[model samples]
Target: MSEEKDLFQIKSCGGRKEADEIKKLLEQNDISAEVKEREKDFVVLVPNSEDIVNEALVIITSQEVYDEFYAGE
Candidate 1:
């Protein structure tokens, strides 16, 4: 079988919880993603494809906005 393709970092989150939330959002949108903890930061990773990476970024940005807005309530 062929080797598994590498995942590229698309976003850096503050912590594991935030990274997991973003990863879950990406998966919910049918885009595969994973979270990697790098020292004090969490990095979100997705397949090394341009289209998927762009889509994931859009979704992550939207979710972050929504979260920030609602978090103030």
Candidate 2:
């Protein structure tokens, strides 16, 4: 099988829980996101959405965005 390509990344986060929150947010918004869980850290990716992803690049790495993710939780 060919390796998959990701369109976005969670460049910075305080912890895995935070990253997971972001992942959920992306999904709730109907945006596909992925999480790579590591021993010490995690990474998140925005795969794609039926609607074009806008402001994603601007908000993906912001704590404020992550806050919204948790607020939804």
Candidate 3:
């Protein structure tokens, strides 16, 4: 038997504000996203890969989505 492992890491630093902001932005654009991982000093948003549908979730997404996240900032 083999265990599962993530291909990449979505790092989030600074604070939760960035993570929350990113989520709201991606959702608004209709780009499915989620918080994949989180740490005391940072948060991680790993995008959904075709390999794993309900497994590896997403954090931040496309350029448009990213733009929206920092729309005001």
> By lDDT, who's the top model here?
1
Local accuracy by lDDT, each model: 0.85, 0.62, 0.49
Candidate 1 lDDT over 1-73, as tens digits, reads 1223667788998989988988888899999887778998999889888999889888988988998999999
Please list the residue runs of candidate 3 whose C-alpha ends up more than 4 Å from where it truly belongs after superposition.
Answer: 1-11, 50-73
lDDT of 2 by residue, 1-73 (tens): 1233535453456687878887787677666667777667787766544233454554554657777899998
Instruction: Tell me which residue pairs clash in candidate 2.
Output: none
Worst 10 residues of 1 by lDDT: 1-10
Q: Lowest-scoring 10 consecutive residues by lDDT in candidate 3?
A: 1-10
2 versus 3: better TM-score goes to:
2
lDDT, candidate 2, equals: 0.62
Candidate 3 residue lDDT tens string, 1-73: 0212432344465776776666566567554445444446545444445533333333334544667879969
Model 1, 23: alpha-carbon shift in Å? 0.6
Name the top TM-score candidate: 1
